[model samples]
Each structure stands twice: as C-alpha cells, then as structure tokens.
Target: MDLFADDTRLTPMPIDDGELWFQQRLPLDLAPDEVMRRLLAETGWREEEIQVWGKLHKQPRLSAWHGEASYRYSGKTFHPQPFTALQLHIKQTVERVTGRRFNSVLLNYYRDERDSMGFHADDERELGPEPAIASVSFGAPRTFILKHRHLPKKVQLALGDGCLLLMAGALQKHWLHGINKERTPRGPRINLTFRLIL
Candidate 1:
C-alpha cells in the first residue's frame, strides 16, 4: 500500500507557503464510479443547518462523519458513525500515501453545481496544531481554491476524480481553502477529508 514508494506520479503542488502533495489519480484498484455509487447509496448523508451571523442556513451539501471521535465546527457537534468497509479501505490507502494516521473522516457530497463549501481554515481546536488532512475526490471534477491568510495571492486547482490532495505542515495555519459553487452544469461529486481527531 506504499503508493509513492515506487510511483513517479506523486507531485508537490506548486505553492509558495505550505506543504501540499497532489496526485492526479491515485494508484488504486477501486473504480471511481463504483466508489461514488457505493458512498451515495450507503452513507447517511444529511444537510446540516449551520448558524452564520446569527442566521440559520442549511449547508449547501450533504455530509457525514465517520471515525472514533466527535467533530465540532460551525457551532455544531458531529458524532462519528461507524466507518463503512469501503471507507476504512480508502482511509488505509490514503494513510499509506500521506504517512499520516487518521481516526476520522468528513464526507461531503456535492449533488450538483450549486452545492459548495465556503472559504475556511480547518483550524478547529480538536484538530490540534499543524494537522495533516488527506482529501480524496470521486466523480465529477471541481475547482479547489486556496488563499493566503493575509496576502492577495491565491492558488486554484482542478481536483479530478480519484485524485488525492494532501495538506500538511503550516498550510491550514497560513492559508484558507474552499470549493466554490460552479455556475455551469456538472454532475455529482464526493469528497472525503481524512483527519486526526485529537
């Protein structure tokens, strides 16, 4: 399961501030379509209502939490559900590539072009300092954006299906990342962000 031990496809994302590794397509035997279908059918996806500026609004996408501990964000607490077999397998694969152990994963389902995530840092207290996040994508491709905390520079990446993006070191501390809503029509997509829940 050592994905980078012999592979030459692993490439570091060209960023000036933080550590990021990007693989256009992970070297895995599982089919992206199959994985997407299974996750859609099996995951208990829910549209959570989050409070922003004292106003309650439904999250644009469906999401589920799986792991060994609870995750708190946006003034809400999410308890972990038992990891599905497919999820555990994928987690192990990502861990092998990133060299990081994750006890929890946040699954986000973007049903269409309108579903999106706003810019934010994954600097929750429970994640501790300098957390490593391994993100895997399936299904349709989407644009992932990263902006510096204080500067005007930004990084834009097209995260393809079956691709893996690893963010470690001071990435979260110095940059904010998010996926904006696409204006053009697009198919559904699933994103799995594996993290260590301390």
Candidate 2:
C-alpha cells in the first residue's frame, strides 16, 4: 500500500520501534455528527443482556466471519449478531486509508462510564499473523491505551471525535490495547475496528 499520497491528508503519529501509527483528529470526508446519526439509525445496536466469563457482554456483536454461530473464546462458544450498513461504510473508509481491503469490522459502543472492553490483542487465528487493524473513532473522545507485551513503556492516545488509528505490520504480535473506563460523564462512542480475516 502507498504509505502517504498527496490525496491522503493523514499525518502519521510515530511509535517506538514498532509499526503502529495514528492520525489523530484528522478530518473525515463526511460530517462527524451526520455520520453518527446515520450510523445510530441504521446499525441495530441492541443493549446486550448476557453474562460471560463473569463480565457483562452486550448485543449487536458480530464475529470476524459472517453467519458464524460460535465465536470461540477460551475454549467456549459465543453466538454472533448481524452487522449494519454503517459498519460496512466505515470499513471501506479504513480500507482507503491503508490501501488494503478488510472483510470484517468489530463495532463496540461505549454507552457510558460502565461499558468497556477488557485488555486484549487482536490475535485471532483468522486475522493472519501480522494483521493491519484500522480503528476509527466516532462521537465522543476516549482514551485508548496500549501496553507493550515485551517492552517497558505504555502508549496512550486520546481518540477524539473523528479520527483514525491504524495498527499495522507487527503491532498486534507485540502490543495489547484497550479502552480504559473513565469516571467523568461522557457521551456515547462508537468504535469501528476494521480487520482483514484470512
């Protein structure tokens, strides 16, 4: 993929010794609020009502592969839900950024202070070995942290409004990222992580 073209108005944020880069607060071609409203109306984000691994999991969740019933996690099976058009649209924009295609997207809606995802790597068996995951943040600003699996330093990025965070090359193999829970009041945030499932 072309690293940076004249048409692409994204500035790369550097990282330590790894291939992780992000363009913070870059303006998207679409209006942020309009896109958010369209996504909320189109995407059927259901309030999840389940308890798994002693943690509360929500609905409107789909796996990397479509039409799959069991999303294997720690030797257990979990069902998947359907995806919305907004998910597909975000994926396409991410593809344009990286000049690579992605087949699936994992959408997480942080409703409030209580909703959060645990720390984990995107090391799924289907995502190949060195996957490129393009994460686009919409709506509210949130702090996304990454702790090196083998290094000493930890990185943090305030993913505000409309921004694109791309984790490419060998990032997933060496780093684990997550969104930490904050105490302050915040609006709903929808994150679309674009991944290519092999």
Candidate 3:
C-alpha cells in the first residue's frame, strides 16, 4: 500500500511567482449536489453590467456578494448582503482548512456552457499585499485557465465538484486567470471565492 495515500489535505501545486493549493474534494456534512441545489434556490443572483474600455456590458455570469465589506471593480462598487447561515458555515470550513480568515465571499453562477469569465487578476488595492483567496466549487466541472502577465506561460485546472483551490503569494501580481466559454453543453456550476479585504 502506498503511504500518504489517505491524506485528505490540500496538495501544493508548484508554480513560478505564486502559490497554489488544491484539494480534490472537501469533506462536508451535506453532499456537494445538495449544496448546489440549495444555493441555486436561495441566492439572489444578478447579472451586473460593467464598463469595459468605456463601454458597458452585462457580465456573462450571474453573481452575488456576501460579507462584511464592500468590493469595487470594473468601475462598479458592490455593497454585499449579509452572509447566509450556510455561507457562514462554508467560510468557517474553508478557514479551518486553509488557515486563513476571510471576511467576504464572491459567488459566481455559471448557468450553462455559454457563461464565462474574462482573464483578470484579483490585485485590487483593498486586498492588501500578498493576499490569499480560497475558491470552492460545486456542481459541473470547468476548465480554469491562468496566464502569466508578462511571460508566455499558461496553466490549467479541472475544477470539479467539491474541489477547493487557493491562490496566494504573488499570484495576483504576476498572473491572470479566467474560465472560457465551452461549445459543448454543460450543467450549472457555482463557485465561491473567499477573501479578506483590508
């Protein structure tokens, strides 16, 4: 038998100029499917418009913010609604696993294969220096792509159901990441990114 096979901890994903830790599945009281269903039924998702190059356009995906602080990006400010009980629990679990405290969460819902996000980094000034963000996913899998800002390098991750990914260190300073739209039909997905705003 292979030693360390049963270890249920986040594995370090080596990359230049950044730190990544991933766990294929996070143990929870309820199943990932159940959590997905609950979030679908409970969240007040909205399709917000943002200005890109001086033109406003609706974001491809629906999203909600829940936390104690306001967030600003893309020329818009979002004053979050209070976190739900389930979201609070999720934050607690994420904090316990990652050893990081997060006061905010940005939840994004990809309704289908057509929904996608453009490449960007979470390098906002309010995040302070060397910030850490924990992302948890439920439901359909998606290919997450990361591209270096000034280098010809790329990385990909298959973000599956119940998986957790942590982006830390100089990642925001050197890399950009996003999810591209896929042609094939796909089910819905929800991703919650836990963060601490200074």
Compared with the true structure, what per-residue lDDT tens digits does model 3 show for residues 2-114? Answer: 11112378878868899988888876788999999999998999999998999999999999999999999999999999999889988999999899999999999999999
Among all windows of 10 consecutive residues in model 3, the one with the lowest summed lDDT is 1-10
**Which ranges in model 1 have alpha carbons more than 4 Å from their true place?**
1-8
Each prediction's TM-score versus the true structure: 0.94, 0.78, 0.96
Instruction: Write model 2 residue lDDT over 82-167, tens digit each, in one string.
Output: 55555656666666766778766666778776667667788878778888888877788888888889878688877867778788
Predictions in order: lDDT: 0.88, 0.67, 0.91
| lDDT of model 1, residue 178 | 97
| Number of colliding residue pairs in each model | 0, 1, 0
Q: Give the better candidate number (2 or 3) by lDDT.
A: 3
* Span of 10 residues, lowest total lDDT, candidate 1: 1-10
User: In candidate 3, which residue pairs clash?
Assistant: none
Task: Give the distance in Å from residue 73's predicted Cα in candidate 3 to where it truly belongs.
Answer: 0.4
Task: Evaluate model 2: give its lDDT.
Answer: 0.67
Point to the candidate with the largest TM-score.
3
What local lDDT score does residue 145 receive in model 2, on the 0 to 100 scale? 83
